[model samples]
Target: MAVDNATVVYFSEQVVILISCGLSFLGSLLIICTYILWPDLRSTPRKLLVFLSVSDFLSASSYAYGVWMVFKSDSVDCVVQGAISTFANTCSFFWTVAIAIYLYIFLVKSNRRLADSWVLYFHVVSWGIPLGITIAAVALGRIGYDASEVSVGWCWVRIQATDHVLWILLTGKIWEFLAYLILPILYILIKKHIHRAHAALSEYRPILARNPQSQSPSSMADLKLTFIPIIFISLRIWSTIRFLLMLVNSPVRQNPVLVTLHGIGNTFQGAANCIMFVLFTQPIRSRLMTLLCFCCHPSRDTAGDGHAPSQRGQGAETPFLAEDTP
Candidate 1:
């Protein structure tokens, strides 16, 4: 007996989505926990990352719930999952763009304090717009059981709605597309500004010798920041392509490989962020390693390392926002 195409697609989509969402949830949760546990890490940039992780956590958990609800075929649960996932996922996109904008202001504009002032506005836009769109989508009854013909093992805008395309764009796709456009442009500008700043600093190197505290931005930090847009676009482009194919009613949209890729790409964002910002960040990783060492060896003198874990609340340097430190 041979397995049919539909069976293959269904199984692949379900498994991939479930696993990806699980990883996303875990990754997002870890970021959130790290933020809460270490007050010193709560710099402006890290706060923005925490907000993004919050949205990712909700989106991933809701997607996993949507997968479970698929089995029950419960219409109400499907709608709820669709609404929550849409709201949270859109917020994630907004927060990602917020991070990019914050970086641009901090790096290019060179107004660090003023850049920090935008945190309130960032919260309002990132959370408020998504909430409004989700409410409108639910009011119009546009979100429900997105059949296997469209979604991977989750609920989203119903395929049956007359305005489903509009709802899809409003709920998530528009913001995602905007993030794709905005993140790279902003990061590129920041990179160019950093390079220019470095060139200018080189010119003043001898004069700056009198001021030992004067320092230029970290090129390594710029390199790490550059990865933000790359990872986001890489993990999200598949879903965008799938959506375009679906819009054209292309048969390739239903291909198991494409569907699996779409599911994994759509759900892997949180994990990608974890890998980029948390594990790859020197400050956070070093702190985490210290904590782990302390936990594993209770008798060891943590203070002997010259950085006591208790001092984490004293606003230590995070340098995650492309500051002087690398």
Candidate 2:
């Protein structure tokens, strides 16, 4: 039995996107809830995760809107959907970069302390920059600024025209390259600096003995922060490469295999990020377990091991430290 290629693409796009978006939405919601429900999790570094989670949640919601727009097409709907998704995507990337930079300073630069003002500044830049980009693009698109709608029944900037292509190439494609390519480079550079620092410490035997048990939160946090970009880049790499291929040969867009691959890869990003954060970071996992225990045992006065939040050991830290140098 020969199945039509068109039928395969149609099925894959609909089913895969729906499932991915649904999982993404659910995962993002859980991340947000976990942060909100537990006050103990609130910290300077965790603030970035909260921001990133919000962006992912919005991204998933925007995808859901795009899926709905498939059945009900309207130009206004298309523009709105494109704008929201673009903003979410842009914010996610910048926030990821910010996290990396923070870790670089903390680990490689040996600067564990970040001022509150500095953290706030990063937050503002992450959220504000994306807002400006999205608004300008949406306004330009509505005013015949040459941006065209794209995506399989969903709305996104078209890659066909020079101006329309710039919208994505600048915001979306560049960020993908930054995360997928430049991040690993940064990781290597930072790791080398850390090794040098460790060697320097070895020269002072007495200092090392004084803090034999004093583990550096920077190292663990760096590992955790680095993994996030890798997870995101890995999940989206297939779709991103396919997109580049489409730029060279537009007809490849019609290939059902590529279409399905792109659909699954791009849509799965939020879920992948959430899963990695929850599973890889022990702090998040332990807090989640505490949350679950609290939920299950309503009569319990304390959560997980009965240690007071303030008394918890600072020895082991989450991917983001609760006691970042303020």
Candidate 3:
């Protein structure tokens, strides 16, 4: 017998979600490990990245677990998975916005101490609000297995809830939408500020003479920041579209291709972040490469040790994470 389209779509969505969540989990884990292994890489920005990865790690893992328990829709584990995913995913969105705000304050406003002063606030808002929302959702009995009609292949808000829309907004969608709006505007403002700073520097050649390399790293950092919002928006737009369709009770919301795309997009954020913040980042990648090379060529240990003294002195003075300026 030929397989029906519904069965084919369901199987495809499950496979895509599993693979995407697996990649995201591994990528987030790598970032967490990198942070733990290298104290030198623990700058303010990198510290924020580690926190973001932690949330992504939880979000992706919970999502994978939800997919695994998709058949057990009414089980307690299903509700637990839904709750955890909601909290962690919301935290991820908040942390992303927090990073943007940190960049704006540090680079655009030139606030050198904002990271130290504002990190507590960032944590309280990013983690605390999600915790509160998740608790309320659980208390109200909103989280459970959403069937294929509502979700791709995971647990989330119950379709039968009288106030499902309200819970959805409180749990995840509201923050996701806010991030979509806030990130682009903040990044654009930061870019314009950098341009103005560069223009001013060009007019005042003496400043450049004093510190010729002052703006180079900032420019490079700006280039990296430009990709962040783009990656986030691209990966998230599919799910957002699905959500809007569901609100209208449109048949297109259940289209297999769209469902697969939504599942992939929802679970692939951590992997995308890993590619952007780890693989493509020069400072972290260089350090990772050097460590790998040293591990592979242990026979050159003596030669490497001989230069350790000078390397240590230079490393102490070098600013590996000084890309925060404009």
Which is the leading candidate under lDDT?
1
Task: For each candidate in the order shown, give its overall lDDT on alpha carbons.
Answer: 0.75, 0.60, 0.73
Compared with the true structure, model 2 gives a TM-score of 0.76
lDDT of 1 by residue, 261-326 (tens): 777787888998887778876556777787788788877754436563444543333336432222
Backbone collisions counted per model: 0, 0, 0
lDDT by residue for model 2 over 173-263, one digit each (tens)?
Answer: 7776777766677666666665566646332232234444425524443454456656767667766766575556455655666666665
Model 1 pairs in collision: none
Which scores greater on lDDT, model 2 or model 3?
3
Task: Evaluate model 3: give its lDDT.
Answer: 0.73
Q: Is candidate 1 or candidate 2 better by lDDT?
A: 1
- Residue-by-residue lDDT tens digits, candidate 3, 1-326: 11121112366578779999999999999888877865555667667878999999998998887666564345788888888989899999999999888878866777758645898999999999999999988888888856644456677887667788788788888898999999999988877776678655332233334456744535444566577888899888888887788778777877778888878888898898787777765545666676667799977665444433432332222212222111
| Superposed Cα deviation of residue 44, candidate 2 (Å) | 2.0
Residue-level lDDT for 61 in candidate 2: 82
Off by over 4 Å in 2: 1-9, 71-74, 114-117, 142-152, 158-162, 196-226, 300-326
Q: What is the TM-score ranking, best to worst?
A: 1, 3, 2
Best by TM-score: 1
